[model samples]
Target chain A: MKARVTVTLKPGVLDPQGAAIAQALGGLGFTGVQGVRQGKLIEIDLAEGDAATARAEVEAMCEKLLANTVIETYAVEIA
Target chain B: MKARVTVTLKPGVLDPQGAAIAQALGGLGFTGVQGVRQGKLIEIDLAEGDAATARAEVEAMCEKLLANTVIETYAVEIA
Candidate 1:
């Protein structure tokens, strides 16, 4: 099974990297861009085949390592 | 309107960050882990409402600034 974890900043949190990207886009003359927020996309290849088990395991991974719970939130998808 | 751009390293590209994550997971006693690949997920808030135009513009942004086409690939999703 394959799992994907998307870790994103929580609402109301400041994202400097995302801000920089927005600014850079403006500099590059790409208008109409009001805001930009950046996050992480982690694709994991697992030996486990059961969908439910994989989702649970990946979620555990997120809570333990993949996401900083105070400032970031994570969502896991299994395929 | 909102758009999302997912940028990932090409298949043949080496990802040290991903390797480190996999190793750390192993160290943490999480077994059955095969591999991990890390990528970027960018969310952009646009003033434009038209889906087609937004997609086109986001793709242009990806080509010109968001992705380093030489080693990475990017997909834009408008919502």
Candidate 2:
């Protein structure tokens, strides 16, 4: 099975990289961009075939290594 | 309006960061991990209300700044 994990900053967390991108977009003459927030998209190929098992394994990966947890949040999807 | 841009390395491209993550997962004792790939997820706040227009604008942004088009592909979602 394949799993996708999206890790993003929690609300109110400051994101300098995102700010830089937004500023760069403005400089590139693309108007109407008010803000930007950047995150991580991780795709994992798992040996497990069952969807439930894959989801549980991926979530454990998130808690253990995939996410910072203090400032970032993660969502996992298994297919 | 909100726009989400997911940028990923094209298939066949080597991702050292992803490899490192996979290795780390193994070190952490999680088994059955076959492989891993990492990408970027960017969320943008737009002043434009129309989804079509917002998507167009975000795509343009992707072309101009967000994605390296040579080895990276990006998808834009407007909400």
Model 1 clash tally?
0
lDDT of 2 by residue, A1-79 (tens): 9999999999999999999999999999978989999999999999998999899999999999999999999999988
Candidate 1 TM-score over all chains jointly: 0.99
Shift in Å, residue B15, candidate 2: 0.3
- Candidate 2 chain B lowest-lDDT run of ten: B70-79
RMSD value for candidate 1:
0.6
Stretches of candidate 1 above 4 Å error?
Answer: none
| Candidate 1: residue B39 lDDT (0-100) | 98
Residue-by-residue lDDT tens digits, candidate 1, A39-71? 999999999999999999999999999999999
Q: What's the count of clashing pairs in each model shown?
A: 0, 0
**Clashing pairs in model 1, backbone N/Cα/C closer than 3 A:** none
